[model samples]
Target: MDGPGHGDAALSAPTLTAREAGLVGCRQCTRVCEAADERCPRCGARLSSRDPGALQRVWAWWLAGALLFIPANTYPMLITSTVGRASEATIVGGVIELLHYGSYGVAGIVFFASVMIPVGKFVAIAYLAILVQRGHRTKPKHLLHLFEFVEWIGRWSMIDVFVVAILVALVQFDLIATINPGIAAVCFALSVVFTMLSALSFDSRAIWDRIKTLSND
Candidate 1:
């Protein structure tokens, strides 16, 4: 039999994972450390190759967010009271009203941020969580990119809450008209917060681990 050569081993060398190399990456700071270390030196955060309860936490928060999203859409987001008239408008209703008033730009923005973005985030988070849990190795890089995109866009999802706050503050008139945030504002804000928590609780390293497994195979 021919002796093992450099070319034969070279192909497998590049796929060696950090754990196999006797190293672990800090989850908080992304610093490489000896696997024996219990804590990250730089950030003082606990060191773990992967979060033990990541999927559980992600699922819990995701469920809460999904539940709250219902009321956020059904209940009124803004209550407008004038001298003798009153009206309640949910997020979609407010967007429609803005469109009817010919403020197309604002209407589109509200619809995109309030309706489209939140729904998209819920779906994306759930998808990422499921993929990571299943250890599905296909398109690992693309999945990581999707997770990062989800985290990056999370803050912007609060645009609706910000709009409600601004209107409540600036559109107050004692006798003429007043705009007040409704129950949906709280529900929507809570839903956004829970979804954000879910995204953060996910361990992106899980995606890479699956990639590493495939490469080794």
Candidate 2:
């Protein structure tokens, strides 16, 4: 007649945030110390629940990454020289060529990794930055999860750069065929790096701070 855990349902475990508990966690070593403490004893890093310039740094890097991303997709990513002929391929063109060659799986992987992932990261990072900056209290937990996902996926976005690097290094044939990385490769690499820095500069604790503020109000 009773639901699962019905006997313990009335007993609630209240959640307490570090700020609510008068604690500050070191960003470097995650050492918990009293909020009154000026620095973390374990790592000696300055402790703060929220970074005042977090959004500014995040926006700066985000803008740089977004700007570089335009040229990265527009220009050729690779230049292949075969005998007397030379061909250049942009990111989309490269994927299309792979598909034309019946390498569907490889093409899909390239398209997803090179195009979709980067764009998605840009959108996700922008969304998180805006939400935190605006101090939106709606679904703070979900926003925190989104921030973590963006951070986790940041490194993987460099797959295209890695592939280009490997090809530029391994595919060398004097008179037969040779592959060289194009300008877009540099732009794309820089875009990935900037976006990664943007994600790293973001302070996820800001999301919870907004939530706590709203709760207290």
Q: Write the per-residue lDDT of candidate 2 for residues 102-167, one digit (tens) a residue.
A: 999999988988888889999999888777766676887688788888898877878888988999
Tens digit of lDDT per residue, candidate 1, span 154-202?
7787999999999999988988999999999999999999989999888
Residue pairs in collision within model 1: none
TM-score per candidate, chains pooled: 0.88, 0.87
Off by over 4 Å in 1: 1-15, 214-217
Model 2, clash count? 0
lDDT of 2 at 118: 88
Give the TM-score comparing model 2 with the true structure, all chains together: 0.87
